[model samples]
Target: MAKTVVQEFTKGLWAEIPPFRLVLGLCPTLAVTKSVDGGIGMGIATTFVLVCSNILISLLRNVIPKQVRIACFIVIIATFVTVVELLMQAFTYALFLQLGIFIPLIVVNCILLGRAEAFAFKNKLISSLADGLGIGIGYTLALAALAALREILGNGTFYNIPIFGPSFQPFTFMVQAPGAFICLGLMLAGMNMLGKK
Candidate 1:
């Protein structure tokens, strides 16, 4: 049982990473990754929602009727998303502004729904918790890596702190919408290559 739980937890880190492996949760992954701050903020908020919703869904799995399970799952996820949004608005208002609509859209993030239905709904509380945390952290790492790449190449900064000298030139395009797509594609391809080896 312990080994199984560990496997469940570790799988999210590599085997089922949301963006690279599962190709899930692309909206915020692409939109908010323009900066490390935005990426980390969005990642943490989504992580909170994922952990809370997963726990609740696992606890209520048996009670949720099969006919309306999907609706019930949404309600659970939306509740946590609202909590995260309000908390961010009160404490991290700047990041709140940065994330904007993406924060609210967490309710519909396929990762939450997918985990709720696929893992949490069928697992024990502890297993569900592990799964959520693992996946949440994995997602966070991915966003940070991508954001770091975009921020450094496009803005010539790391976490808004200048890293390069005056002689350095920023590739401004790396921070644009097109850059997000290209970067994601590159990362996905890299993951596949590594997977094969």
Candidate 2:
């Protein structure tokens, strides 16, 4: 029993990382990763929804009809996403504005739906919660890594903290839309290589 639980928990970290391995939440992954702060905010918001929806879905798995499972999961996930959006607006208005549409877009993030259908619906509550946490953290870390690279090169700063001397020239392109594709492709390639080794 313990071993099964451990496997379930760890599977999400690398074996099924929502962004890197599964590629389920690319919209937010690519959209909100312009800055470390934005990536972290998006990660936390998604994590909240993932964890809440997973637990709820797991608990109601037996009751929700097979045909309506997707609909039910969406409603649950949307509720939590809305809560996170409102909280961000109330406490971090500037950040919220920066995130804009991507904040609400969490409702449709495939990671949440995939987990609800694939893992949460079949697993126990504890195991589902563990999966949610592992996947959420994995996604968050990937976004943070990408954001760190972009911020450092594009702005000569790391998470708003200056790391280079004033004489250093910043790569203005690193923060642009094209930069997102470049960084994500490189990061995904690196992750795949590392996984093989």
**Which candidate number has the best TM-score?**
1
User: How close is every model to the real structure, measured as TM-score?
Assistant: 0.99, 0.96
For candidate 1, the clash count comes to 0
Candidate 2 on 1-197: residue-level lDDT in tens?
A: 78877887788778887777887788888888888998988888888899999999999999999999899999999999989988998999999998999988888888899989999999989999988988888888888888999989989998899999999999888898888889989988998999999
What TM-score does prediction 2 earn? Answer: 0.96
Off by over 4 Å in 1: none
Lowest lDDT sum, 10 consecutive residues, model 2, at 4-13
**What is the lDDT of every predicted structure here?**
0.95, 0.88
Tens-place lDDT per residue, model 1, 1-197, is 99988998899899999999999999999999999999999999988999999999999999999999999999999999999999999999999999999999999999999999999999999999999999999999999999999999999999999999999999999999999999999999999999999
